[model samples]
Target: MDEWLKAGLDYVPRWIDYQVQHFAQPGCAIAVAHQGEVVLEAAFGTADLSTGEALTPRHRFRVASHSKTFTAAGILKLKERGLLRLDDGVGNFVPGLHPDIASVTVQQLLSHSGGLVRDGADAGQFTNHRPFLSTAELKADLVLAPPYGAAERFKYSNHGYGLLGLIIEAVTGEPYTTWIMREIVRAAGLTETAADIGLMTGGTLARGHSTRLPLGRRLVIPGDNLTNDVASATGFVSTAGDLVRFFSQLSPMSEAGLLSPLSRRDMTRGHWPDSESVLDRSYGLGIISGTLKGWDWFGHSGSFPGTLSRTAVFPAQGLAISVLTNAIDGPAQLWVDGIAQILKAFHAGGAPHEEVADWVGRWWMLWGAVDLVPIGGKVFASPTALTPPLAEMSEIQVTGRDAGKVIRASGFFSPGEAVARLRDGRGEVSEIRLGGTRLVSQSAFADELVARYQGFSKDRA
Candidate 1:
């Protein structure tokens, strides 16, 4: 790895720790792949909060909606084999009675442009109010009129995908889960992935945590509610590592992968804008394509009850990253973006500017130590829990001898505080204080505290 890459990799663990600890998440897992190899894998916090079980990398998460990507691949695989075409109408093979729903082409279903109902009107199963739909229930839901006409606009439909699973069964004469596991998943080198909960055996599945409501805590439980035919739509389980590996192969740059270059390009190329509000996001066949940090990327996000996930593949960088969280409101997207930021900063980080040379030091107080670093004349607070890392030391004009007011600090409650570098008789910095939180030199911290106590005692008398 290049120095920047190495530096970025080294920082990943610390960042994960910071996010899990400070953000009040149950825990999260991450996997990053560069040039087709897994580089960093980590798990932080407890997987099973009730039992206080620490999460491990091997734990599986209910990668809901990511199943769409796999199912889409199966459809494409069939197309490649000349069994079906993207333009084939759903009504032909499945023998459906609804002309409107049947008239929709296969491609539209894959791209979520089929205008099918997203979830049945009674989707209480998702909220655990009722059991998940069976094949018969799914069929009953499919007969309902679509919310809109075909190719009307981008409309996400789990029902659309569940129909595709029926079509897959019609064409292949086998179960959707079995066919996909044999063809798409196993072929892609994922031994840990499964289509639904029942299929998930032998390994530990990451217990899905409940969402922290307005004033509630997240708890661990079974998050995979989608079963039976719906498994093809929103039911899948995977590790962050497997997710990255699978998406990396979807990049056209891969010499040999699950799909042909033509198929990969067709799948990643944006077909329709995701919404009127989103300019950068669009849907391809089973894939969500968007831009990050100005680089085009394509992948999918999974949102189970207690899990949130996001994956992105930057073909230019030959890189893929996946962040999986067992909590209901995991910052998977932000953390994924944060990783990209780290990589970007590492490459941008060069020699420090002259103005920052004097600012480099470890200042301390009773609370903890704060390391001031100047980068290219700009000071940044590193990641810390105690105080905001002085991210940007703006308006650094001196206020007094051996003391200056840091007009800005980065942590909560530390900003706009008077930061003074107190000097000893020898003109050395004895300690520093950001507001009332006195941070002393390491060697002098205890003595400084003792002296302050003694002085306070005398003043009281």
Candidate 2:
């Protein structure tokens, strides 16, 4: 591994673990791949809060809406085999459809520009108020005319992907799940993936949890319901490790990939802007794309009732990252972006030398925690609460064995102030002093709080 990548990977797990504890999230899983090889796989917190089952990298998550990417790949694979074309009308394959919806081509549906209904009028299936729609119910909903014209703009529609599922069934004389599993998922060399919950076998499935606001406490949600007909849109289950592996192969720069270079380019090209949103993102064929830190990336995000997940592939950097969180309000997107920021910072700073290597540790104060991270021979005092911890960070220039000076920081922070590491009887660093404020180990801080504020000894408390 490159020294810069190694430096970033070394701190990613520590940062994520801190975030999980500080935010009280159910659990989070993360995986990263570089040049088609997985370099890191990690998980934090519990899979089921009721049982306290520790989340592991092997645990599977209901990666809803990522199923659309798989469905799009299946359609493109058929096109590669001369079985279908991107411009073919849906009405040609599926017999019954509203004229407007039927005229929507396969490419439009892939790009979410088909302007089909977002979901049928009664979308109780998503909320667990009712089971997922069956074939009969889905067909009944498709009979109605779409609210917008085909190719009007980027209007998201789960029903459009469902229609693509029916089209897959029509093109091949097999079920959507069966064909997609064999051709797309397996062809991409993924083992920890399934088209739907019913087909998921082996490995532990992480149970989802609701947010703690309205309920005052999290309740376990068994996210194992089967999506009957809409499985092609919102029914795929996978691990963070497998998700990165699968998405890495979708990069156009990848030499050995499932699709041809032309198909991959067309699929990932930003075709329609999300004009209604302020995110400055665009929708591609089965892909969502944007620029971060001057690097263009393409991937997908998924939202199930109890889970939120995201993945991003940076073709220029040859990197793919996936984050899975087993809670409705999990900050999966923020976590992924933060990881990218950390990597970019490390890449710019290079590797740390032995002089500052021992300066690494997470120290706490009354307000929150601060992480002393060593990168490129300098120490960075970063706050634990921030999504990208390096934001507004203080740079320390080590002057001696146990002394440093804060050379760069915000105006409110102690810039150009003396910093020192206090040692215990055994000569181990026990506390740190940044200017006038003192920070101690987490355990010591907790004990101090109980003893001073609560008026009780550690054992008594």
Candidate 3:
């Protein structure tokens, strides 16, 4: 394991333990992939409090709206095959719903701007059914409203994606579940991911749970009395391993391969700024697009009766992280944010290439009594023993076993040879050597090197 990652893994359990005590959660699971490698996979606590079954990587959990990305991918596949255009109206597929709804297009549904009311009124009808929903049957509950804001502005609609499910059925002449399974799920090699709420398939699927009822939320699953009728809109179950693979196929900006590169790019192109009221996160084809923790991240969150889940993909770094917890509220959200922070610290150094650091802020680090302040492109440190603060013109010498550079008024150092190597983006220090101990640390020499150079830059802002 990378030393920093090892340390992070150690910290994860500590955090998870705190969560279980505070939230009364049964258990939590986390998976992280970096450079296409599974760096961290762990389960904390029990899967079932009553039986004392421990959680495992193979446990399945209902990912709630995380299913939207899959449904969106199926729609994109239909578009890829030239069967439909995203701009095509809903009236083009299901002829049964309000014919006036023709104005709402596939693109609008994927972007959640179609202004279709949620399936709130007759949702109980589907909940009582065992078979996969037919296109017309699914549309029986939807109601249409005027476009929310000139079309393509963010207004999240589960009903809008339900319409896309209808379109998928129309284009393939197959059930929505069948089409998604054969086309996107199978092709993506996600043998463990599926929408088969009726059949209870997907061998590694985690059992969905809920805090609302001690018996857990009842849903329609195949071969078992358990299944939730919310399939098309929010009824898919997956393991973190499968979700990691699912995200691996897409770019940071949007879905690709499932749709034409042009369409994929277009879908990811933010149609609405995140600042708009009621829509703080913009939509992209089958993905959510936003900047988080100084990285361009895209993905969605999911929630169900007993499960809350989230997955984030940092495309620029070719990394993806996901967390699933089978309690109403658990440590999953914190785990997601912590993973992002760990990645930020890991890749803190090196000159910017494809990514800009305009959003990365200064971070604090301490090695024994040496206090490091990362600001304006430099890591500045001062000794308490110094008679007075080093004057602005004072030449601060760099010291260490290795020959490193010195900041005129700041005691930051960059190994003279390592700096040139990092400048070329070839050499990256993966561990920190501190106090004669090679202890694993998040802030290594690279971060300090980057800040040191920035401190000497002509502009300090």
Candidate 4:
């Protein structure tokens, strides 16, 4: 890995952990891929708030609308095999659509321009207040008169993708899930990606939690609500690692990518701007394409009942990141965007620019841990707890062997404050005292913990 990328990867976990805790989310899983190499995979917080089961990278999230991306790939694959065409109308294969609705082309459905009702009046399936739509139930809705004009503009319609799923079956003689799992998921080498809720089993499925609503506190959703016939539109479970791995291949021109380059270009190229949206974002064929950090990228977001997920693929950088949250309120989008900004800042100036400062090291105190971090040739004392991840404690200038004095630590210590460093006879740093806390060396951490317990015991009521 390049030095800048390696350093940026190190920052990924710590920063993400800070944000995950800072937002007090139930849990978050993140993964990053650089040129097909999984550079980082991490998880934080509880999978089940009720049981307090800690989450791990293996945990699965209902990557809801990400299913559309897979479905789009399936359509393109069928096209590759001469089984279907993008211009084929929905009525071409699937029987019994309203004449107006049936004539909407395949590309139109993939890009959400088919003018189909999104969920018709009962989207309660998403919240488990009602069951997810059954095939018979979905068919009833599609047969109704078209509500919006075909090929008019972008209007997101999950039910349109559902119709596409039906079309997939009509053309392929195989269920959508079976074909996608074997052809797309397996072919992409994604072991953890599942085609639908029914197949997401035998592993750590993250229990999604509700956002705090007008009723008051957030509650845990069992997260096993079936996606039913809508799996092609909203049902898929995966890990962050698997998500990034899959999306990285969406740049089909990339090495060993699954989709034909022509298909990928058509899918990723923006087809319609999300009206009034300031982000310069547009909807493509099952993909969200836009500019980030001046790089044209394409990816998607999934919003399930109690989960939120976001992904991005920077084809220019050969990089991608996926963030999944078990909580409805999780800032998966913001976190992913922050990561992209961080990478841009690191990579913008060409090389790593300056070397890591000499003073950076781990330290221990009664409160917890603090890290002396070097960024851009300067040191900042970062408290692990009791402060944000990179809160400044003090910047110090070396004064003697294994010793330094405080130059400044905004909001923590005064300028010229003594940052006394005590060392063993071997000239190795043993402990550091600053801001009325003694940070013991790693070797002495056990002793400090013992002393902390003793202090706790003495102060007990």
Candidate 5:
């Protein structure tokens, strides 16, 4: 691995752990893969808050709508075998569909342009109010005329993928889960993934949790419900490690993968713009794609009842990342983006040199914490609250072992100022001074605040 990448990975877990603690999230698991090999797999917080079970990289998450990517790959795999075609009409193999839906092509459903209902009238199945739709229930929803004609616009429909599952069954003469697991899951060299909850045999599945609001406390949600027929759409259970491994193979640059380079290209192409979304995202076959920081990323996000997860593959960087959280309001999206930002910063700054290697720690002030990160040959005073922590950071040029000068910073910050470290009688650095501001370790700062304002509570009362 490049030294810059190593530096970024070294700090990723620390940042993620701080975020989890600061936000009081249930738990999160993250995995990163480069050049088709996993380089980092870490987890923070707890699997079950009630039991205080520690979360680990081995824990599986619902992964939810990420199943769509797997299903899309399965469909393309069938095409490779000459078993079916993407342009085939749905009714060609699976009978008993509404006239309008029957005429929709397979490609339409894969790209979510079939204009089918997102979920049937009652989406309670997603909120745990009812079980996921069975084949009969899903087919009944398709029996009704679609709200829009085929290819009118982009419309996401879980029922559409459910119908694709049925089509897979019809063409292969096997159950959706059985065929996908044997052919796709196992074939992709993923031992830590399952098509549905019922098939999960190894590893602990992290229990989901509700938000700590409206009730003032989080409630444990048993996220083991099986998706009977809609398993292809939202029933995958996987670890972050397995997710990154699978998504890495989806890159067209990958030499070893389940699909041909042609299929991978078509699947990741930006087919339809998500006009209704603010994120400038697109959909292709079954893949969700977007661009960030001038880098094109293609992957899928998933939302189960009390879990939210996201994964992205950057082909140009030969890197894939997966972030899975076990809370309804987890910052998986933000953290994934933040991780990317950190990686980009390190790549831009290069590796830390020995001159400033030890000048690394998170220092606190009255407003917030600042991470004194050593990168390249200098140090950056980066705010902890920002998603991209290193953005607009203050650059420090070390002049001595315990002294530096702020050479670059915002106009409001103390640029062209001398930075110094204060040490105690033991000759250990205990505090830092950035011009007029005093910074200290978190524990020291807390103690100082308590000592200085201990009587304020009583006076206010």
Candidate 6:
């Protein structure tokens, strides 16, 4: 194994130990890949606490919403074949489905900008319990309201995704699930992964168990079958390995043979600004765009009964990570770090070993007022305004590989505040500082003067 892989493997025991201490999770599965090669595929803990079936690399788990990327890719593949345009409005596909939804477009649906309410059914609606609604049925039953506006903004709408799935069925002349299997799944060669909603009732399925009490007394009940039939927006189960394989294609220079270069870029292009200042990180079609650890990555998070999953791919570093837990409340935060650390160790050689002067710069957050500016090649942070006596600093660090660099700093300046860091991607000294007191910092210090003030924008990753 390569040194990075060795390092990643070394951390597994530590991760397992940590999970045991923090969450008491039964078991966890993690997959990490770099430059199209999976260096680490290990499972720690138990797939079933009672049975003591040790989690293994071959184990499968429901990747919940992580299925969104596959479904979105299926829709985009149809677009690639001249079947539909994202700009095509929702009404065009689902004719007369909703009179109020005549103005919503497919792009809006993908980005969750469509003004569809989050849940169509009230709490007591599904009380006694019933079979899940089909895709078209879901669209009709759940889509109760109209778009808030024509402009796209981020508002997670499951109904919007359901509508997207419905459109897929209409355009492909097949059930949404069937079309996805033939076009995206088959094309991607994911034979083992599918929307197996009722796997528990059938053979060759992993039993899903919840960590907490059964909700509505329907615990351990078979998942709704509608989940698979109408999977365009949600509803798909996959293995960590297969998910890593599917998402590996999304990296900028990947060779996964799933998406063409043009298609990959098209999928990543920021279709709509998610918020005010973050131009780089936004939603496009069905994918979320952003940077992590200094690498431009794209993917989504998924959640369902007894499942929570997240998959991310760092394009510049040519790395991807996927984690799936059968438990309802998995170690989500630690899981992300575990994969990040794995990627960092595997691709450590590729990461910048020596700091560069150009790496020092200022960054502005998309939502916060903190500005990270480079001064004298060292790092300094000013909370409200960039002025003198800007507390010298402590524990400064920079992370993220080439093209996606962030500066992090901890201690003193902003007590109780998360260590501040410079945001990634932009060339100038402007960066968005995440996790600190949002005390509206103003850029009053002169740029040149700040540069000579012995403080660069400390990376607070």
Worst 10 residues of 6 by lDDT: 383-392
lDDT of 5 by residue, 341-366 (tens): 88888888888999999889899988
* Poorest lDDT segment (10 consecutive residues) of candidate 2: 451-460
Root-mean-square deviation per candidate = 6.0, 1.9, 12.9, 5.1, 1.2, 14.3
How does model 6 score by TM-score? 0.68
- The lowest-lDDT stretch of 10 consecutive residues in candidate 4 is 348-357
* RMSD in angstroms between candidate 1 and the native structure over all alpha carbons: 6.0
* Candidate 6: residue 459 lDDT (0-100): 43
- Cα lDDT tens digits, model 6, 327-401, are 667765446655565345335433222352344333333222232323323333433121111223322344432
Better-scoring candidate (lDDT), 3 or 4: 4
Error of 5 at 442 (Å): 1.8
**lDDT digits (tens) for residues 1-461 of candidate 2:** 99999989999999999999888999999999999899999999999999999999999999999899899888998999999999998899987888888898999999998888887999998899999888888888888988889888899999889989999999999999999999999999999999999999899899999999887999999999999999999999999999999888889998866999888888788999998898878999899999887878899999998999999998999999999999999999899898888888888888788899999999999989999999998999999889866897999999999999999999999999999999999999999999888999999999988778785554577
The better-scoring model by TM-score among 2 and 3 is 2
Give the best candidate by lDDT: 5
- Each prediction's TM-score against the native? 0.81, 0.97, 0.67, 0.82, 0.98, 0.68
Give the CA lDDT, 0 to 100, for residue 118 in model 5: 95
Ten residues in sequence with the least summed lDDT for candidate 3: 415-424
Off by over 4 Å in 6: 123-130, 198-204, 211-229, 272-281, 345-461
Residues 362-432, candidate 4: write the lDDT tens digits. 78865666766555544456665432234355666556545556677675455676666677899877777
Backbone clashes per model, in order? 9, 0, 23, 0, 0, 30
Tell me how far the alpha carbon of residue 45 in candidate 3 is from the true structure, in angstroms, after superposition: 1.4
- Estimate every model's Cα lDDT from 0 to 1: 0.79, 0.92, 0.59, 0.82, 0.93, 0.59
Greater TM-score among 2 and 4 belongs to 2
